[model samples]
Target: MTISLHRSATVLFQGDSITDVGRLVEPDSPLGNGYVRMAAERVLTALPDAGITFVNRGVAGDGVSDLRARWREDALDIQPDVVSVLIGVNDTWRRYCSGVVTSVRAYENDYRTMLAQVRDELDAQLILIEPFLVPVQDEQWAWREDLDPRIQVVRRLAEEFDAELLAADGLLNQAARAVGGAELITGDGVHPTPLGHTVLAEAWTELAGL
Candidate 1:
């Protein structure tokens, strides 16, 4: 299957650190170092004549609110045909480590609002990637109670927005269990290793049919 949004279109990626793996911060270099870069590379290689432009506007530690704040400047201004987003890990992580409690209700509300803007205002194809954690440490396992609900919210939002859903969480967990465990994928419980990112990119590609 082909991802038929718009022909020869520009695709914009938005989210937190996982997405913002050090994008050049210059127009000359837009693809970051994580799944975004890998996905772009695959698209270029597979569809060399498609002439799609890929851009990453993910900030290292952004939450749903942060993405909302920069939506116009980073995303809307670009007027992309497809907008892919992976967020909510920081929202859950902050509650665990920084006493910043982003309740499930609040997370869902903010995330829905952001997606609505993309759907109504920009008229773009939306791809919502589920936030993931591999449980490398004890504390990471506890994060499930908080993170799982947010992941559910993303699924609901995807349905509401008629968007594509990329189940990165399940894919990574299965990959980890198939190999060794969470440690091999994510050294900590959050950030992914190079191999982990590659897994994510491949999963996204397969799910998006790109």
Candidate 2:
């Protein structure tokens, strides 16, 4: 699917570590080194006079609840003309690693709450990126049981909101397939490397029609 952008759009990127990529909370290149930065750079570089302002509000290790908590400040307050969300992996990861389970139902509820608020409060177009896994470890494979349901919920939400859906999970899987599941997609099956981020950038820019 093609993503359309307004002439002078204030684009907001929100989510977890994948989007964060060690950005300074202060200023000066807050988009970090992940897909957000890569995509933003490509867009700005391609059209220096597009008047597109990009903001990255992705904090490391954030979940749906975290997003809901900060929605007013990071999202709505930004008055974005377009909002892109790339969250939910942490919610699934914590279940196995930290024993902190966020049931699919709870995950969907929290996600729905945030999206509903954004819809009610802003005229921003929405782009929802799927939370994905690559399974570097055998245990990571099991995460599918929990994560799949959440992915389905996100799909439903995108349909309900008529939002643009960036199918990260499947896209990453397809990439992994070409490389035969090498650590190429994600060094640790979660956080992406620079090369992986490039892969994401290509997908995102194409999604944005940039």
Candidate 3:
């Protein structure tokens, strides 16, 4: 899919901690230190003359439901040309760690609602990224049961909404092979190490046609 960039474009990224990557949230530099930053850097270099505004509104530990609650302020208010959403990990993580269950139905419903809002409010293009879990440790493998369903939900939504889907699950898994299959991109199996973010950044740029 080719995402045609206009001379002056505004792009907004929304997601959880992996996306957050310790952004200051202050005015000077809010792009953070993860894939979002890497993606933005590539975009800037690719379109040096273009006036592209990049906004990162990723909050650590946020799920689909949280995104819905803050959609107005973080997303709608930005009124971006392309809105990239990478979410759903927390929905799966909370279940295993805290026994807080957010059913697949609930996950899909909330995600669909947020997409609808973006469609209606901004009429912006969508980039949907899948949530992934690489079992670097033995215990983390069990998370697949919960996370797989959510990944499918995101894929289904991407098709339904006519959005571009970044299959991060497959990309990250494939990336692990490069970094020694026994080792992981994330120490905890959730967050991405710098190497993991590089893989994601490259994949994201390719997906966005940057």
On TM-score, the candidate that comes out on top is 3
Model 3 vs. true fold: TM: 0.96
lDDT of 1 at 96: 86
Model 3 ranges off by over 4 Å: 25-28
Local error of candidate 1 at residue 94 (angstroms): 0.7
Q: List residue ranges in candidate 1 displaced over 4 A.
A: 24-29
Q: Candidate 1's error at 206, in angstroms? A: 1.8
Which pairs of residues collide in candidate 3?
A: none
Residue-wise C-alpha lDDT for candidate 3, range 76-96, written one tens digit per residue: 998999999999989999999
Superior by TM-score: candidate 1 or candidate 3: 3
User: By summed lDDT, which 10 consecutive residues of candidate 3 come out lowest?
Assistant: 178-187
Candidate 2's C-alpha runs over 4 A off are 25-27
Q: What is the C-alpha RMSD of each candidate to the true structure, in Å?
A: 1.7, 1.5, 1.4
TM-score of each: 0.94, 0.95, 0.96
Deviation in angstroms for 173 in model 3? 0.7
lDDT-based ranking? 3, 2, 1
